[model samples]
Target: MAGILILYATIEGHTARVAERIAKGLRDKGYRVDLHRADPAGASLDLAGYEGVIVGASVHYGRHPGHLRALLRKHRAALAARRSAFFSVSLSARHKPAAAQRYVRKFLRRAGWQPQQAQTFAGALPYSKYPAWKRLLMLAFVGLAGGDTDMSRDYEYTDWDGVDRFADAFARPLDAI
Candidate 1:
């Protein structure tokens, strides 16, 4: 089986959910899947033998985890050699249709790595999960973007079906290869 590596950097678990769904979808399709977070202290999962890789990250203030960026920089060559995909989760993805896909350009430039497939998934506003500073920061940011500002509960906008389809698409190219 072609092992698939799914790496993510999450703040309030939306990106984690996306990673889980993608991993499960790939596994159900008969591929071995590895799930990991791009934290420096996390295990250095062996990506050498994987048949493919999918890197996911959620944006806060238009940036991803520096830890993930480091991994991408270190594994640039290896990732480029494999069947690879990149998915970025952000509130901006929930913007108007014309503005929704706006993050790819900045993300690509910041990550300095590109995959065969790239996707943008809507993220969440986990006000309840945030501390006071985070909550206020998000509120201000959300306000500027015409997003919900209530800090009572969390809000998620990820499209699950879209995630599954993306996984299938990634699997499609691997199957072809």
Candidate 2:
């Protein structure tokens, strides 16, 4: 069976959870899915083994994880030659459409990825999961964006249905490839 590789980089785990859902959705359709977090500093894994590749990452301070960027650059040629998809996760995606779009564009350009399908999904603010400093910083940023700032709980802004649809979009292309 052909394998589908999902590599993600997440902070506070929201993107990780999304990756899991996407993997499950793909697996449900009988694709052999291999889910793993992108290693920033390590030996570059050969992407030749996977028939299709999906790369996901969350934004922090207006940038993606540095190591993932390097990896993407290293494999950009091979990835562009195959069926590939990219997803960016961010809290700004929920409230700041312009910022989210700009970030997505920036990431795509920086990563040298020209995926047939790309998605910018809203991420979450897990106050309970954050440390004191992060909670305050995120709450302030979110509050400015007109979002709930209560630090006692978490807030999720991702649209799972949209995520499912994106995964489905890649499914057929993956199978065809």
Candidate 3:
């Protein structure tokens, strides 16, 4: 069987971590998974070899990476021809579910690619990893959003169990086939 393709775009690295967890869940179910990082400079992707594909991206400032949107536009037909899913990672997913859903809707509408499955996963706030300006900015944002504001440490909001469930759901139809 052709393997499942797990492609992701991350800025602060949390989205990549989420993608890895999803890949692990699918692999545990006996699916071959290929994990690839989406390049911001636009890398060509061929989806013919994969039985299914899962695309993930982190939303920053209300937007997903432009290159990922471009990739979806370019590969929409190939992705449509196969089983596919999309998951969006963002801070809004943790505090504001509606906003998170809007992000996904906007992204899909702009890209013109609708996957068979879609989900929203809360992301992390890696305060320690950010530069001073970003850390302060995030601190203020978190404070206003009623989230963790401790800049000395990072906060993770992702639900691992949910990610596993999503992986299982994506694999079910393929397994049936």
TM-score of each: 0.89, 0.95, 0.97
- For model 1, what is the C-alpha lDDT against the true structure? 0.83
Which is superior by TM-score, 2 or 3? 3
Backbone collision tally, model 1: 0
User: Which candidate leads in lDDT?
Assistant: 3
Model 1 lDDT tens row, 83-173: 9889988888887434445566566666677789988898888898888998898888889889887778789998999999999999987
Q: Tell me the TM-score of model 1.
A: 0.89
Tell how far residue 58 is off in model 3, in angstroms: 0.5
Ranking by lDDT: 3, 2, 1
lDDT of 2 by residue, 60-149 (tens): 998888788778887999898778899989987888878888887888888787888888999988889888898889888888888988
What stretches of model 2 exceed 4 Å from their correct place?
A: none
What tens digits encode model 3's per-residue C-alpha lDDT throughout 58-112? 9988899888998899888898899999999999999999999999999998999
Model 2, poorest ten-residue lDDT window? 39-48
Q: Which lDDT value does model 2 have at 134? A: 85
Give candidate 1 misplaced runs (Cα > 4 Å). 41-45, 96-102
- Provide C-alpha RMSD values for all models, in order: 2.2, 1.3, 1.0
